[model samples]
Target: MNQPSSEGAAAETQSGALFLMAMLALGTVAPTVFWGLPVIVGQIAQQWGFGAAELGIAVLGEVFGMAAGTLLMATVLARRPLRITLAATIALTAAANFATPFAHSLALFIAVRAVAGIGAGALSGIAMSCLSYTKAAERNIGWLVLLQVLWSMALLGYVLPVVGATAQATGTYVCIGVLALVFLPAIALFKRAEAFVSAEADNSARVDVRGVMLLLGCIFALYFGVGVLWTFLEQIGMRAGLSEARVATTLVYANLASLAACVVMPRLGHGNGLRRWAIINIGACVASAAALTLPQTPDRFAIAAIVFIVAWTGAATLIFATMPRVDTVGRYATLSPGVLSLGFGIGSAAGGELIELLDARAAVGLACVFCCVSLLCYVSLGRAREAEQDALARASQS
Candidate 1:
């Protein structure tokens, strides 16, 4: 990754609003696709009469592609020029998306979507690298979260009114293809006054490979919980005797309310305040998971689900923020997306298996356990970081 000069890092604080919007849009499209898979797959199933399991496999393929693509951009392509790199990636993704609907066989469709995922993941890698250059990382990332939710809402609105299931669906690939083309021109705006992470910087800060792995693992587990919770949401509602309409309506409002957490947390400062709130939010996720799975009326389920989203939104922003602070070299921050996306894929698959093996309640239990793992990992990361910083301070004084 290109490390910026001290001058460039200082300049990052004053980035224009237009640049922020462009970057946010760039980072969010991949997440929107990941989160919207259910609807996309559902539409494909309706159009092609594909069975459930086949579509699920296709979804995994795309997600795996995304993970691979992000890692490639962040590492091998890290030295590539920004504008040209983004243009190539965006074009590749759009081209793949346009080709998606033409696939007649299961294998071919997955292959096409996987190619698209690679491009999309490359876009995400570049976007995250750009965003890290800014000083207001959490706030900028908060806005990204806001955009992702809005896009997800739009996807749900677009997909549900028409038709859908999980990964293999994409009757709307053409729509996403069009979106990629629109973003293609915005690569110009991605350029910065201070170039992103320069490999030449001699800053003595050593890369904490162990800490980075821990954080990456935490991200994976957190998303795994997210997968389980999302998988069983409908079943959770059904058990509460709620209609799908009611569940959908509740989901909308819950995400809408979640917007506030994204707004409020960043403003609270990113030191002790961030640490304190992160712990609380993770705890809330654990509780929400339990509340959803445990026997409950419609009211209880609604409340738990709402809190679950709120915690997730807040926790997500802070979790990403941790990367730059942990690995100042910026090497690991770039790889975080690959791990994060991979986690979501694995988590979703695990949830599906748990549901079949036992029941929705069992899936919910898995979500709770995943959340616990993430929370514990987060705590360890915090303690290790503080110890390192303290030692650095002592050495500087001596």
Candidate 2:
């Protein structure tokens, strides 16, 4: 048998590593706010004395701002210089995060987070576009997915744990701000968006209009559930008699669940097997949410949280993995984030109002419904894909 090289693997090579590292940096930071909401928002509420409704509204503003920024990049800035665009967004993200600790007023904080969201959203749009254009987009995307899980683990696990122990939420923002700046050095390695465009100009790259739209809708619905659950996850744990420390630690373990999903993601590929897994993910999500409806126990809470993160990872990966099956144009995949963010913002805002008017249980039930809606959309997308394949096959036979 041939022995593997000392370098470990092909993707671990210098040039690939450099490019992936740069892209990985952006990918990790892109969804930090969304993924770390439980920790960050929990800290903000503890320190700032903001009510659930107010914080939920603030989340809505920030995520919608991110949606706006991503949309702009996909359209107006499509032709812009890559390095310049990425550098500017990175700086803006850093500035916004650093400024967050100063937003004593609700309005001020909303504005600051919106700024940060816009910057991060644009960066994400560009990065995904770049990834889809890679020689091995699937492999690169798998690594990118894994990178997000690892970074989130650090954010929810180590960084926030130590820094958020005090009465200050400054550590959360400051650390992320610093990491945003860290991405600046990676800008030089970024090729222009145009450079990533595939040289093979084939009709197959064209998007299936109906199929892609279903995907966007599915992404939106899935993230809506995520937004509702994730926004109040820590708070929910508190309601369940879990301490903040325990809840935070549980999130770290939950990230491990997401990491496991990412590793298993590639082998699953896309089709019936993938859809079956998606159903299991949905079941776990609903089951986890239902736990909050029942009496809250520590072990139960831990189990639910782990399952929730698994569902989160699975829903997100399903979107990415399903993209090529539906469309290769690359444009739709970039837009999915904005759509999901919009749904997330709406869900967070709605969940907050529900929490204020009703209870966390009510909000969680609603979130479960959204997850089902997402599943239906997923089913529709799969059927659309089959229909397209059938049409192509018929045309070929003729």
Global Cα RMSD, each model: 3.2, 6.0
Count of clashing residue pairs in every prediction: 10, 0
Q: Provide the TM-score for each candidate, comma-separated.
A: 0.90, 0.79
- Writing each residue's lDDT as its tens digit, candidate 2 over 246-352 gives 99899878877788787776557444566667666666676777775677889988888888888778757656666655655455556766787899888877887
Which residue pairs overlap in candidate 1's backbone?
2-196, 2-197, 2-198, 3-197, 3-198, 40-169, 41-169, 42-164, 42-165, 43-164
Top-scoring candidate (TM-score): 1
Q: What is the lDDT, from 0 to 100, of the residue 135 in candidate 2?
A: 51
* Residue 271, model 1: Cα distance from true site in angstroms: 3.9
- List the pairs of residues colliding in candidate 2: none
Per lDDT, the best of the predicted structures is 1
